[model samples]
Target: MPEGPSKTAEYVATFRAVESARPEGERLFSDPYAASFLDGKLRLGAALARNGMGQRLVCRYIDRNWPGSRPSAVIRTRLIDDAVTAAIEGGAEQLAILGAGYDTRGLRLPAAREIPVFELDQPPTQERKKQRLRARDGDLPSNVTYVPFDLLDEGVGAPLERAGFRTGLKSVYIWEGVLSYLTPEAVDQTLAWITASGAPGSRLVYTYVDVALLKQGGEDEPPWSSQVAKVGEPFRYGLDPAKMDAFLGDRGLKPVWDQSTLEAIAQHAVPGGRNAPGFYRVAEAEVLPDR
Candidate 1:
């Protein structure tokens, strides 16, 4: 992976999104603009992904090097997409993407016109993404705003307020492929902020890995945890799936849907693909009305 804040390892998720819609008949969600974020390199990965062996070779390298990122990237993208769209249809008025690294949903989704999107990340990644977006379209969509957020240094509530996030409008908050890199306490703080800040009936769509595997000698730690640690971005936050409901309830977020890898595979994995227990899961939660 690249050096900091989900650099090279982060881009892999984008590449895998492009791969999801290859060859024609076998496809998942279609993201034509996913390549624009890549500066054209994902097309190369798409070529490599054409055949079974080449695809396996590319994925194998990512697995050995990055550990367990592929499945969550693939599955969570689709699930979050669904959750966000559903939220919007159900009266969501804004989108807040936490750790939004090169994600093009705001640019590509038609509903982007229906609500403003706020992409929050570290400054460097956000700057680069802005430059790339400018080069491709001359300027960003008027409804799309870029916000710099250092999750370690701060949480979203303050930055989002500064960026004009409406506290009264229902919103869909997307926290994908990011919690594992955060400390558990920070995760709790962030979720607490979302629960307390978002309007009643707002929704949060997030992905988190299993906490047991992340702890010392837990039942299902992903083998990639060590490689990820070696790269200096070891996991600090995780949630035991069994306790996830209570965890969210405590934070004033109600679990609406939670999908394990087994369910994701049966529902969305490409036909007969071999994916290790990336154990990453996608969930949707509702902000409880103020009592």
Candidate 2:
């Protein structure tokens, strides 16, 4: 068997494996396609499992604290699920996953099969993902499409639009685990493009970390924040819930949901305690016409 693909592809392939390994765990996210996509990527699977152990530990902690609700992992899963639901409810016929990597929603979700699912990523990332999926005999749903382009390039939007995505129809844009890798300017530009390119009722679900956590001058903070920074993926953009509202408001987006760690834990039944120190944040909003 060919040795999997690029780093990004391998990373995602492993994520699928870990997600699959959780027994009766499919109910957590129910991604049956994960295992198949991970075949032949044993190293990736092992790596993902190693990383996921920490996450699972956190989830277990959250569960001990916030019983009777979904765990933090489930909460994160629902965040994405709700965004997809909102898009469908808003009459969106298309869904675009930016920095798609090895996302399996196009393969696992029935609704995704009904609506066109576009996976956007760099050429190498996209090519490698396709190779892995093909190797596993993974069948992409008929509605799935792949668009390759660098998000930083000015021409990014053109290729997407040319590949059957239109500004006139409602769409859902998912940017999971992506914005942290970008600069503030790039983040703004990406949002601007989505606002300009999506029709009314379209929505965006993206994640980011608090900027205060990124700054060294901040008061007592979690060790994980600094640790993540040392890993070279420091959180660059932090949004004051209010500031985020205003920022998106100016861009014609209506903030529908903003979740803090505690709030997400409560809402999703995550088990970690407040002592665990939350570092990641997720938000969802809709593109509305100028008021």
lDDT of each: 0.72, 0.64
Residue pairs in candidate 1 whose N, alpha carbon or C atoms collide under 3 angstroms: 2-8, 213-221
Report the number of the highest-TM-score candidate.
1
Question: TM-score for every candidate vs. truth?
Answer: 0.86, 0.77
Q: Which stretches in model 2 have alpha-carbon errors above 4 Å?
A: 1-16, 23-26, 36-74, 217-234, 269-276
Residue-pair clash count for candidate 1: 2
Worst 10 residues of 2 by lDDT: 1-10
Question: Following a full C-alpha superposition, what root-mean-square deviation does model 1 have from the true structure?
Answer: 3.1
RMSD of 2: 5.7
lDDT tens digits, residues 1-291, model 1? Answer: 233445543465455544554655556676665555553554566556657777777666655654445554666666777778888888888899988887777866777566899988888777777776788789887888888987776566888889988777778898877888877677878888887778889999888877766665454445667656666767777888899778888888788988765468676655333553636677888999862
